[model samples]
Structure formats: structure tokens, C-alpha cells
Target: MNINIKFPDNSVHQFPRNTTPLQIAENISSGLARDVITASVNGKLVDVNYPIQEDARIELFKFDSLPGKEIYWHSTAHLMAQAVKDLFPEVQVTIGPAIENGFYYDFDKDVPFTDEDLEKIETRMKELARENLEYKRREVSREEAIEIFRKMKENYKIEILEEIPPGEKISIYSQGNFTDLCRGPHIIHTGKIKAIKLLKISGAYWRGDARNKMLQRIYGISFPTSKELNQYLVDLEEAKKRDHRKIGKDLDLYSISDDIGAGLVLWHPNGAMIRNVVERYWIDKHLEADYKIVYTPHIGKSELWDTSGHLGFYRESMYSPMLVDEQEYYVKPMNCPFHIAIYQSQKRSYKELPLKYAEMGTVYRYEHSGALHGLMRVRGFTVDDAHIICTPEQLYDEVEKTLVFSLDMLRDFGFRDFKIYLATMPEKAVGERQNWDQATESLREALHKNKIAYEMDEGGGAFYGPKIDIKVKDSLNRLWQCSTIQFDFNLPQRFNMEYIAPDNQPHRPFMVHRALLGSVERFFGTLIEYHSGNFPLWLCPIQVQILPISENYEDYARSVYAEIRQHGIRAEIDLKSEKIGYKIREAEVRKIPYMFIVGQKEKEEGTVSVRRHTAGDLGSFLLQDIVKRLKEEILTKK
Candidate 1:
């Protein structure tokens, strides 16, 4: 019998039952077969050699796609592992996995890998790749797999095997006398990987538990061609120059202290000013959109969390509860439950069905110290959170509005490229199946109606419900998840939240947890890198710098600064008695958008010489005229 295979273009063809993707690709065309990196059947990723035994929807990927890149990176990781084993016979590989940028492999070796070692390993990997070694998979019983690892003295592999449930099919892949346990549909041959680079080495606790032995993890990147690899290396260097931690310190924007704790951030004055501007703009926009801005306490009764299911599902990330008045209290990890409590404070009706509550609430979470980085990953941060409680009839409209608002908000910040995802219900989810299906369909329809393209994340939704996640692309073309519009089928039912409907019967209201700019701290860090510290006029903390040609023009500079301040420009005057050139350089270093230079010629004329950051000096203009231009630019958000 033949199986009906549906291609991505919605075209279907009959194929032999045991025919593989490789065979199908060859039958279609030799060019497609050569270009195809991998294929997915019914949303499940599989290698080109995977047999198509049943009717399925097939998607073929090339090197450019995300899934294809991940598969390629993972295969390179195995090649690197093979190279290490050949170079250092004593080194024992534990686990290697592909990440966002590249791949890393952990090894239980006594000596840490050095720079010289990385170079040697990379050279060996390239040599092996050119050998065209074929990858062969062998399935074995769990007991037999454990025995194989035991004979090889691979303790980590044995530990992994012991944890697997009984009767689960186990397999090992081998290429050129090197074998390791894996659940793989790897590329057919090593020759497919064209370029490889071993980046660096770091220590990682086995299984992420500090108590376990520290293993040396080697990170690397690979590409199908040498040119792409070279481009990625160039971008990698540029990323280092724009590192947020270095920029933060240079501009005195923020700091993370060991004394205060790892993941908590201290926002310096400059950073706070930026945050204040963002918050004010956020409030004004929400108010214009008819969102009621409200405040909630940082801590809530433990019973509230228990009712919201946070205690059960999200306890690992939440802080330990403290006893207050003989009852437990938890620092809120979220603000939605508190918003629900406020709704419960008064009886609501169908007329008030679509209630939008917005807040700039700070919440605490527990992140491993090792994972903490500058601003991006923090324990304590404010969330630009909002929730919309609406009736079933209004669900799709509300979702669409939230999506549009999110796009507008991001656009105002100069983000142009967006990648949207519609995540459906996971296997382990709460709420009725019918409700989940309806909510997922509503989000899908909203995306379609708005003409927004999105990918379906088959099971990427929270356990509570489905969601729409929007990721903004930065200057380096890196995607950052900033906006989320999630349905909450669990909360309304858990809290018995309802609004009286037109039929005079109480009905559970649909709740959408919407966050644009996800976390203030993370978004701020992203902005620092996105703008390269040269923020737009409206968001710049110090919009203008007043520089005097000499001490003789100090008074003139002060007057210019004062006049600009009166016009609501964020201005600073150079009072260090430094040369005008030095002051201008200092202003440029700080990335101020504009600079006003004063001299005797300009002071006598009541005019100031202007300079734009990263640009040369402009001709002199009357101070009032310049102020008007600045105000207009700021008002227009240029």
C-alpha cells in the first residue's frame, strides 16, 4: 500500500509505505535532494533517511531555517565530540546539545580545555568531516546499553541510561569507531558539515547541580559554507563591542553587585531616567487605550498563590514563603492574581466585560547565580504587565487589538522586524479541552485577520493556556522575546471569576495576560545594544550637552543649558573647565543626541553652535529656534 504525503504547498502525492524523505526528495529532483538538510513529518522532526510509514504532512528544511540550523549544529557537536575522543583518549564525553547560537559539549576531564586545545580539536573536526564518515544507528535493550557503557567506563552515559524508564527504545550512533547514546536522526554523513569553529571553554556543573562534579564545556559554531561562518564571526566580534555590561559601566547606567546578590540590579541615575521616560510613555499610551492603571502590593497571602496554582506549578521559580501574622506570604512572582482579587472586590457586569488593568509591577523570581547576566537575566525586575478580562464574544477582537498595540509600542521604540508565534495547548495543561481549542482558534483567527504571519509552536504554550509570543529583531538581527498575549483558562476557573452576561447568568470571563516589553530590565538591556547606546531623542536620558569653548564662555553655556531645560530638554552643562574639544568628545562618548557649543562669537549673537552625535558640527542658530526644533523632534519621537 502507498501512503499519501502532503507537502508544505498543500500538494499531496502517493508514495511507497517505506519510502524515506531522501527517496522522495530524489524523486522530486536531484537539486532538492542536495539542498534538503532535514524534514519534519506531522510536525515531528526527522532525518532525511526517516521512513515515511504513514500519511503525513512533510516540511523540508534547508540551512537557512531555524530547525535546520539546530540539526546542523547538533551534528557538528557530535563531530567535535568524536574529535576530542580521538585527540585525548582520556577525555570522557557526557552530554552535548545545540543552543541558540551554537553548540556545547560537556566532558568529565581532569584538565580544563585551553585555547590551544580548542584549535587542535577544531582542526581534527574538519579533517574528520572531510573523511565522509557515515553515521550508523544501532538500537539495543536498556540493559544491553548500560552494559556497553559500563564496558567503556562511560559513567555519565551509564547514569543517563539508568534513569530511562524500562522498555523505552534505546539507541546509539557511531561514526568512525566512536559511539554514544542518542535519540538521533542525524545527517547521513560527516561531509555535509563544511565549516566549524570551537569558540571557548567553561565549567558547567553536571546536571546543573553544583553538588555534582564540574565538567568542562566547550562551545562551538558551524555552518554549511565558509562564507556564512566568516560573517557570523564578524557579527560575534561586533556583539562583543556592544556588550551591555561594558556599555552599562562606561555610561554609568546600571550595575550588578555581588554584595546585593547576583540577579538583582541597581539602576544608576542614567538608567533610572530612561526607565522613567519609558514608564511615563507606557502609562500615557495605556490611558489612551482605556487601560486602568492600578498598583498592587509586592507580597500577597500564600493562599492566593495556592488558589492561582502558582504554588503547585511554578514553585521552583518562586521565592520561599515567609510567615506573616502566623500565615504565609509570598512575594508575588506575577500580578495577574492580585488583579483578579481587585476584580472580585466588586460585582462586575456584562457592560464592564472587557476590563483592561495595567501595571508596572516589580516581581521577584529565583534564578540560578550562574545564569545571571547584565540586565538580561535578573531576579528582581519590573514587568510591563496588563490583563484583559473579556467575554467570549469579544475574545478575538481583544486579542487582535492587543497584537496591534504591541506592534505599535515596539515600532515606537524603532523595532521594525517582528517574528510572531502562536503556541497551542501542551499535553500537560489545565482547563477544558474545548476551551483550549476555542482559545487557540481565536488567537489564530486574530493573526490571520490582522495579516500577521506567524509560526505554530505545536506545544509551546504555558500549562494554563495558549498564547501569542512576539519577538523583536535587534540591530544585529537577533530575536528577543518581548511581547506576549496569553489566555488564562486556569485562573478564571480557579478563582471562580465571572461577569454577569446579557442572559442574566454568571459566565466565566476570558482572561488575557498581555505583556509588551516583557521585563523592564531585559528590555532596557536590549535597547542599550539595539541603539548601541545612541538612544533616540525621546528616550535619551541626556538629550543635549552644552559645551563652552573655554571658561570664558561658561556663563553662556549655563544660559544655553538653562534655556533648553526650560523647554523640557534633558540638558547638561560642562562645568569641568575642560577644553571645548574634550567636552565634545565626552558628550559623544556618552552618546547624547545633540550638543550645543558656545563661544564669544555665538554668545554675543545670542546663538549657539550645534553638533549632532556621531556627526560633525552644524552652523550656529539662535537658541530659541534650536529649542523649537528640538522640542518638535522630541514630540514627533524622532
Candidate 2:
């Protein structure tokens, strides 16, 4: 018997029945056979050794491809399981899967894994990889799976098997003496895992349920070659160097203390100064763009969430309600509800169709302890949120204008490269079919008209609407999600919002919720990493630091700094008794944009030696000249 295997290019190949994809690859080319790690059959990833029984479309995945990475990392996870079994034979492996960053394996070990154990396991993993043992996949009956794991005394595997649906064919992957309950698409052999390292160990609840047993999760990353591994390690080092948590502390920008509790950021004076400048600029730009600024309360009645349908879907991220005068109140997790309430406050007319309301609204959400990382993921943060209420005919133009506004603002913040994604209706959305179609089409047309290239995510939107998310690329080539525009039809109908038409008929209005700097805290953190804390003169908390030659020149330095400060420059006087060189170094370490050295010779002539933060020896200049140059740099938007 023969089977037809369709290639991605629509070409079909006749292969003998039960022929494996690996065998077919070998027939085509030995190079491809060696490189192919996995195969996608009819859009589902499967092991290369899996038998082909029916006609199906196939795509061979290499190490660089997404499916290839999945298989490689999945194979590496098997390697990790092997090492863990060897090191702790008493431990039971429940599950291991490949994640975005790498692979993680959950273990029911008697002892909690520590950094030392991770190092030991990593060393053993290298030894196992050296063996180059073949990874074999086998189909087993549910009863057989239970018996095998039972004989091995792996109760975790038994528990997982019991929950599997009846009559389901169970699969077991065995590499060396370690076997796991998994549906695998692993590499052909352990030799394919050339470069591997265990990164971290953390405690995770079984199946992510808080009530389940705590399992030790060992995270690791792997590559096919040493060069790629080395590059990854170098990138990790660079990320650490650019970590905002470290830079924020070194510069005294912000701090979080145990007394203040977790996920609550206490912005110091310096950080507040930078926030003030950014907020002021943001307000001016929105006003110039014909946006009306509105203020919303930090907390609202819990019933409001019910009307917005957030309570039904987004309750996990929301704070618990507080009883207030026989009513429940919630600290807002999103500003959309209040903005919608304002739109419903008055009877709207078609002449006011495209009413834009913008706000720097602060919101609070209960981010998990494990998920919170410095300012990037926080419990309390302000959103540069806005909403546009328009008629259906105005949908395309409104979306286009919002995209233009967001992209231009991001460019002004020095983010030039961006990737856009149009996320369609979700599986759990609540909107009429026609409304969903119209909103999705309008968003697509807006992107197309603006000449912005974007990829479509089949079902990545909220439970109420479709959306477009803009991910900005930073200096290190990492993408940070910064902007989002969502088209919501459910919210307007849920809140019973409407606007009067030209012909005196009331009808539902389309709602567009958008945020350029999605979360102010996260955006600030990304900016810190993108520029490595060397913010532009305008955004820098301390734009200039005045370093005097000694204590004798403190008065002169204060005068120079005062004059600059009077001109709206953020200048600080270093009046410490430290040497001039020491003060200059401190200024550089603080990432101050400019340093002005005021000494006896410079004080008499009303001149100061200017030194840039990164570029040294900017030489002597009149006080007024330096001020003019600094002001120009600040005034220039981009």
C-alpha cells in the first residue's frame, strides 16, 4: 500500500504505507534528514518517526523554525528528565513542556531543588546528551500505562493518567531508562541536543491550581550548536546589564520596600520628576490632537463591572470588592468602564459622533507574585487610555487616526521599529456575527490604508472585541508590547449606550478603546532598558549636574545651576566636598545628560567646562551657550 504526503508547496509524494517522515527526508537529502527535527502534519506537530498512514500535508521543520524550536526544546526536556531520574531515582516526573523562553519540567521530588541542585542536574544533563541515546515513542493502553508507572512507583504519572478521558490512546516517550507520560514530537536522538543549560528552579502548583501539590519546576534552554548557545548567553548578559530594576536602584529612580508591600512601586522624587515631564508632554500632545481630557475615580461601584461584563471574565485580575454603604466597590483594574459611563452620562448627538476622551487614568490589578517583575509588571499603574465613540461609518477613519497617533507618539519616544498584530474575535466573545465581522474588517482596512504590515492572530482578542496590538522593538532587538487599539461592540450594548442620529433615531455607537503607552510603568521600564538609562535631555530627571572644582566654588556652581534651573532646565548643584573629578564621575554614573564644571577660572569669565555623559571633553563654553544647546536638544521632539 502507498500513501500520499502533501508538501507545504502543494506537491505530493508517494510513500510506502507506515513510512516515517524521517525516512522520507533521508530519501530527499541527507542534509535535510539530519536537520529535520519535527514535522507538521495537517498543521499539527508530530514526531519525525511517527508513521504516516493517511493523506496529509507535511512541512519539515528545522532548528530555526518555530516548530523546530518546539521539538528541540521538547527533546531537551527529555534530557532533563533523564538527568533528574538518574540523580533522584525516588522522584516522579509528572509533565514537562517547552515554553517560550525554554523548557520546564515538573517533578514530585522529595527535596526542593536549589541552585546547587540545578547546577548538578545541568552537569548530569550534559553527560546524558553525550550518550546520544535514541528517544523512542510508543503507544500504550491506559491500563498498561498505569501498570508501567505503578511498577516504577511514579504516582504523579498515575494521577495524570486517571484524569485522561476513557478510551484515549496514551503515548509514552522513553529515552534511556527514563519514560514519561507525554504526547511527544521530539528529535530523533539525544545527539540533536548539543547545547543545554538549566537556568532556574521555582516552585509551581500542580496544574497551576493553587490548591494542588507544589512541584519543583526546573527551567532550561538548549540549542543545536555551541555558537547559538554562546550568543544566547551573551544576550542574557546584555539583558541583565539593561535590567531596569538594577539601573532604577543605582540611579535612585524608584524603590519597593517590604514595609510598603509587593507590587506597589514608590516613585522617588527623581522618578516623579521624569513622570511629570512625560505626563505633561502627553497631555499637550493629546490636546493638540483634539482630545478632551477627563478624570475618573480610582475606585468605582462593583455593579459597574457587572454592567461592563468585566466581572464575568476579568475578575481574576481585579481586586476583591469592599463593602461600602451596603454596596460593593472595586479598585479599578481597567479604565474602560468609567470612560463608558461618561459617554452614557449625557444624550449624545450624531454631530458629536467621534467624541474622543483621553485620560492618564491610574488602575490597580492583582498581579501574581511570580509574574511581577519590577516596573514592567506591577499591581498599580497609570494607563494612557482613551476612548472614541463614533458611528459605524466612522469606524475606519477613527481606527486609522488612532493608529497614526499611536505610531507617531511611539516614534517621538525614539521607538522606530514596530511589529503590528491584528487579533480577531476570541472563542469566548459576546457580539453579533455581523458586528464582529464589521469591526474586524474595519481594523484590517485601517491597517491596510495606513500601509502598516501586520500579522493576524486567529483568536487573540478579548472576550468582547477584536483588537490590534503594536509591539515596539527596543535597542536590544527585543519586542515590548506598548500600544493597543480595540474595537468593542459588546460594551456599548451591555451598558445600553447610544447616540441620537441625524434623523432623530437613537442607535448604538461603535467604541474604540486605545492606549499608546499601554501602562506608564511598563513603558518607563522599557524606555530605561531601550536607552540603557541614558534618557534624552528632556526626559532625564536631572538633565545637568554642576560639578565645582572644590568647596570654594560651591557658591559659583549654585549660581550657574540656579540660572539653568530658572530657564526650565533640570539642573542640580553637586555641593559636596568631593573632588571635581569625583563629582563628574558620579554624574556620569547617574546618567546625567550633561555635566558643567564650574571652577575659579570659569567663574570669573562666566564660562563652564561642559562634558557629555557618553562623549567626553566637550570643552569650555559660555553659560548661556550651554543653556541654549541643552534647551534645543530638549525642545526637539525626536
lDDT values, one for every candidate: 0.89, 0.88
For model 1, the stretches where C-alpha displacement exceeds 4 angstroms are 1-79, 89-116, 126-196, 202-217, 222-231, 426-429, 473-480
Model 1 residue 179 lDDT score: 89
Give the local distance difference test score of model 1: 0.89
Candidate 1's error at 75, in angstroms? 6.7
Which residue pairs does candidate 1 place in steric collision?
none
Q: Could you tell me which 10 consecutive residues in candidate 1 have the lowest summed lDDT?
A: 472-481
Which tens-of-lDDT digit does each residue in 79-140 have in candidate 1?
99999999998888899988988899999899899999999999999999999887878899
> Candidate 1: TM-score?
0.78
On the 0 to 100 scale, the lDDT of residue 575 in model 1 is 78
What is the Å distance of residue 404 in model 1 from its true position?
Answer: 0.8
The CA root-mean-square deviation of candidate 1, after full C-alpha superposition on the true structure, stands at 6.3
